[model samples]
Target: MIPLVDLQTQYKSIQPAIDAAALRVLASGEYLGGPDVSAFEQGFAEYCNVGHAIAVNSGSSALHLSLLGAKVGPGDEVITSPFGFVATTAAICATGARPVFVDIDPLTFNLDPAGLADAITPKTKAIMPVHLYGLMADMDPIMSIARQANIAVIEDACQAHGALYKGKRAGSIGLSGSFSFNPGKNLSAVGRGGMVVTNDDEQAQFLRRLRDWGQDGRYNHVHQGFGYCMDTMQAAILNVKLRHLEHWTELRRAHARRLTCQLKNSAVTTPPEPHCCRHVYQVYAVRSASRDLLRAAIATRGVDSGVHYPRPVHLQQAYAGLGYMEGDFPEAERAAAEMLSLPISPELTDSQIDYIAAAVWSDAWRPRAATANLGVKSTRDLARPAQEQSEQAA
Candidate 1:
C-alpha cells in the first residue's frame, strides 16, 4: 500500500550520512545546546534568508516562544485562521492570548487576508497566518494590514518549510515564523524538532532566552521560561537533511504537477497553486463531494489516504468555550468535511502516482451505491499516523 509519507525510504537514501552524524554526536559527549545545534541554527537561518533561527524542541514550542517574544499576553488577542491544525490556536492560547478566528480563502485554503481587517480590535496584538498544506499565505496584503494597524505578524509555517511567497522565503516574510521538523515533514529531523526564524535582533534574543529557562548566564534566571532547546542529535540530523531539501522539494512539486494534470477532469477538486507563490506540496489534498466514499474506494485498491484534519479548531470540543458554532466560518467548515490527503513524498515513484490518481478517478466517477458495494474498509477508520503507516508498509 502507498503511504502518505515514506520516512523509512528517506532514511535509507541517506543512511551513511545519518549514521556518521549520529555517531559523531554520540561520541562527542556534548549534547544539549552544543556546537551541532549552533551550526544547524546558522544553516537554517541562512536557508530562510533571515538574521536568526532559534532551534526548539518542536514547532509548537517555536510558536509559543515567538508569541512570548512578541510580548503577546493575557489581555491581547491574536487573529488566525480557523481551518489550520489545532497547534496554531494552541500556541496562541499558551501565551495567555485569545485566538480570534478568521475564515480561510477557499481557493488557497490559507488564511483570508480580507478577513483580517474585520477581526482586529484594540486588543488585537498580532495576526498569525498559517501557510497551510505547502503553499505560503498571501503575505503582501497581510503585512500591509498588520503594518497599518501597528500589530505583529507571525507566520505559522510548519507545513511550508521551503515555500516562497512573492520570492521571499516563508519564514522571512513576517516578524517571525515557526517550522516543524517532525519525521514526516519536508525537512524531517531524526525526531521531533522545530525552529523559529526572524530578522529582528531583539526578538531573536528574547526567543533564545525563552527556550532555555530564561537564563541570563549560568545558574542565573532572568524570567520564567521552560525547557525547549533542540537536542544535538536532532540538530545534526536536520543539518544533514537541509542540504537535500531543494532537490526533494522539486521532486514533490513534480509529483504534484503530474497528479493534478492527470486528475484535472475527475470529480475531485485539485489544490490550487497560486502564481505568486511556490507550493512545496507537503500534502497534496483534494476536495470531493463524496470524500468518504472516494477514500474507501481508494483503500480497496490498496492505496492509503488521510484527512489532514477532520474537524476545524473552532468546532473542537476543547475550544467550546470560544463560543464558535457551525457556519461561523463557512469555508473552513466545508473544507473540514471534504479534504482528503493522498500519498505525497519525494520517494513516491511515477507509477505509484499514476496508480493513485487512476484509483481516485475511477472511484470519483462511480455511483455512491457502487462505491459502497466495494466493501473496502476506509484507512481513516484505522486512524494511523503517517509514520506508523510507513512502518507498516515496510
Candidate 2:
C-alpha cells in the first residue's frame, strides 16, 4: 500500500548514518543538553540563516516557549489562522493568551492578511501565521500589518523547514519561528523534537533559559520555566539528517511538480506554489468538493490519503468557550472539508508517484453513484501507521 508518509523507507535509505549517530550519542552518555544538541542547534540556525535556535522536546513546546519568550501572556490575544493543526492555537492558550482566529487564503491555505488588521485589538500581543502544508504564509502584508500594530510575528514553520518566501528561509522571516521534528516531517529526527529560531538576542536568550527550567546556571533558576529540553540522541539523529535535508526537499518538490502536472487539468484543485514562494511540499494536499469520496476511492486503488485537519480549531469542542460559530471562518471551514493530502514522501519512486496521481485523477472524476460503496475507511485509518492512529485516538 502507498502510505501518506513512508518514514520506514526513508529510515532504511540512511540507516547506517542514523545508527552511527545514535551510537555516538549513546557512547557519550550525554542524553540531554549535550554537545550533540548544541551542535544541531548551531547547524540548524546556520541552515535557516538565523542567529539562534533553541532546541526543545516537541513542536508544541517550541511554540509555547516562543510565545512566552515574546512576552505573550494573560490579557493578550494571538492572531492566527483557524485552518491548521490545533497545536498552533494550543500554543497560544498555553501562554495564557487568547487565540484569535483568522480565515485563510483560499489558495495558499495560510493566514489571510486582509482580515488580519480587523482582528488586531489593543490586546493583540503577537501574530502567529502558520505555514500550512509547507507553503509560507503571505508574509509581506502580514509583516506590514504587524509592524503597523507594533506586534510581533511568530512564524509557525513546523511544516515548512526548507520553504522560502521571497528568498528568505521559513524560520528566518519572522520575529521568531517554530519548527517540528516529528518523524514524518520533511526534516525529522528519529523521534519527537523541535526548535525555535530567531535573530533577536534577548528573545533567543529567554528561550534558551525557558526550555531548561529557567536556569541561568546549574541549580540557579532565573525565571519560571518548564522541562522542555531536547534529548541528545534525537539531536544527534537530526544532525545526521540535516545533512540530507536539502536534497530530500528537492526530491519532494520534484514529486509535487509531477503530481501537479498530472492533475492540473483535472476537476480537483492542485496546491499552488506562488511566484514569491518556494513550497517544500511536506504535504501535497489537493482540494475537491467531494474529498471524502475521492479519498475513499483512492484508497481502494491502494493509495492512502489524509486530511491535515478535519475540523477548524474555533469550532472544536475543546474551544467551545471561544464562542466561534460554524460559519465564523468560512474559508477555513471550506478547506477543512475539502483538502486531502496524498503520498509525497521523498523516498517515493517515480512509478509510485505516477500511480498515486493516476489513482487521484481517476477517482476524482468518477460518478457519484459508482463511488458510493468504495469501501471507505476514515482517512486516519488509511493514511497513518497503526501506532500513530492509536496515539491520535488516545
**Per-residue CA lDDT of candidate 1, range 8-103, in tens?**
999999999999999999999988878899999999999999999999999999999989988999989999999978999999999899999988
Structure candidate 2, residue pairs in collision: none
* Per-candidate clash tally: 0, 0
Candidate 2 residue-wise lDDT, 286-338, digit = tens:
88778888888888899988998899999999999988999999878978888
lDDT of 1: 0.87
The lDDT for every candidate, in the order shown, is 0.87, 0.87
- Worst-scoring 10-residue span by lDDT in model 2: 373-382
Please state every model's RMSD to the true fold in angstroms. Answer: 7.8, 8.3
Report the poorest 10 consecutive residues by lDDT, candidate 1.
Answer: 371-380
Q: What is the lDDT of residue 44 in candidate 2?
A: 97
Q: What TM-score does model 2 achieve against the real structure?
A: 0.92
